[model samples]
Target: MKILIVGGGMGGTILGNNLARRLAPEMRAGKVQLKMLSASDKHMYQPGLLYLALGRMTPDELYRDQVSLLEPGIDFEVDPVVSFELDHNQVKTKSGKTHGYDILVIATGSRPVPEMIPGLAENAETFYTEETALKMFKRLQAFQGGRVVIAVGVPHKCPMAPLEITFMLHDYFKDRGIRDKVELHYTYPVGRVHSLENVAKWAAPEFDRLGITYETLFNMKEVDGANKVVKTEEGSEAKYDLLITIPAHKGMEVIESNKLGAGGFIPTDKTKLTMEGRTNVYVIGDTTNIPISKAGSTVHYQVETLGENLAAIVKLGSPVREHDGKVFCFIECGKDRATYATFNYTVPPDPKPPTRAVHWFKMAYNKLYWTSARGLL
Candidate 1:
């Protein structure tokens, strides 16, 4: 059997390695083949981009060659996928070639869809892509003082990122002795800071302490760049000298052309990572519309379950592992401090509230996680 994996983000790369190692014995027996397709040769450590944007880290620290990272015995393809013919179990690449697979894993992840919001794509600058993010970082450094608004667009990857930006901006201006010259505003479509009440509670006090103004349940509709104003769905206009917005995120166009799910995100069973209504197709990571935080930790959590289940499917033709929607986030609050929050789909009896201690733990975990993943210890 041949397996085709798309998109070499955190989930795809890790899952590819896990599956390659797991199926090595099967490959020796001529029973399995694994192939990974990615659009670029550079593998980006996305979470680190946050630190990079804040000037706390450098770009070299967040990038690795894709060819050097994949596990041995897995074939890597550096080409963009143009479309997927689900009925034929084949994918067409931008290079005008087609590859067929017995099993396909869709991990193409989401990208910023700024056009979803009127004038957003043309007006406000975004930090979703590596290129745009670096540009924004430079702009932020030169910013003297003005009405700086950090707004969250719908279905964003890493739900806490906007909040992180807000906190870091607060700390940035304060250190520059221009905190009073700048007015910070954070807007989100959700009615609260975070979807989880526990997280919102932890974040609320900090926002208040920082004196950052925020609007909840306010969906940004248009960015009137000519007037330096943002209009929300509630008919409210926010004036700003500079706008840093998180644009709407959507799955790869290939997934949408194939009619996979709404916004091109594949619908999957959380436990198995298997694409719903399809046999022998699985999806992991940010490409799926999973009701969980779309972060690297989520990818790591899903990979283990997906590997075991895939192995079970190969050995016994049945899934033997279940996935628990467990996710952990390391939220950087600037000033060299961060917070750690872990949650499962099922509510915990006692959710550990966020604390300063969690901040230190988050910093420590970053070193540990990167070292482990890169085998650099």
Candidate 2:
């Protein structure tokens, strides 16, 4: 059997590496084939981008070549996938080439859709993508003082990213002796500051201590760039000097055109990561409508599970395991400190509350994860 994995992201690359090493003997004996399709040659350490935007890390630290990262035996395709022909069990690329596969893994991660929100295209700045992060960094460097509003858009990757931005901004101004000059506000559509109520319980105290204003359950309707104002559904207006907005996110257009699931996200059995209607297709990462925080760690766990199940299917022709809906995240709260939270559908039923030890654990885990992945630690 041949496996075709699309989008060499955290999920794709990690799973590709795992499969390549484990299946090398079988592949050498002509038992199976593995191929990875990616849109770009660059493999970025995306979690590091948050530090880069905060002026704590450099861009060079986030760069790695995709070819160099993967094992030599895995075939790598550098092309953009334009469509998925589910009927033919094939995928068509922008270059007019088609790939047929027995099993297809969709990891074509989500992207920010700034145009989906009015006035965001013209006035609002963002830090979702690397390009936008760098642009916002430049703007932040030159910003003297103003009402800086950091707003969280719907269905964004990394639910705590907005809070990270807010904390980093507070630290930035404190260092520049302009903490009093800037009025920082964090607005979210959710009923709480953090998506998880347990985290929100801790976050509330932090926001109060930082003197940052917050509005929960307020959905941003439009950004009146001309007047430097943000309008919400509650008929409330917020004036800002700088607008850092997280726009709506969506799955790849190919998935959307195929009518995969509600809002373009593929509906998958949470444990299996298999596409609901199709037997041969499986999806991992942010492309699936999983009821969990869409973070890199969540993808890592899903990919590990997927690799094992795929191996069982190819070799034993039987399903082996189920996903536990486990997710963990390290939320950086500035001051050289962070907090870690772990949650599973069965346990606690809420994000584990943060502790001072979890904060240090987050700092240490960053090094541990990077080192393990890069073979440094």
- Candidate 2 stretches with Cα past 4 Å from truth are 349-377
Cα lDDT tens digits, model 1, 1-377, are 88898888888888888887778899778898889889999987777767667777677877788888777788898987888787899999989989999989889998889888887777676777677778778888888998998777878898778878888788888998999999998887888877767777778888898798888887888888899889998888889988988777888888888788899889988877888888878898889987877788888889888877787788788878689888877776766566767777785323354467777776666556544344222
Instruction: In model 1, state the lDDT of residue 60.
Output: 84
- Model 2 over residues 154-216: C-alpha lDDT tens digits? 888888788878887898889989999999999888788987778888888889999999988
> Number of clashes in every candidate structure?
1, 1
Query: What's the TM-score of every candidate structure?
Result: 0.92, 0.93
Task: TM-score for candidate 2, please give it.
Answer: 0.93
lDDT score of model 2?
Answer: 0.81
Where is the poorest 10-residue window by lDDT in model 2?
368-377
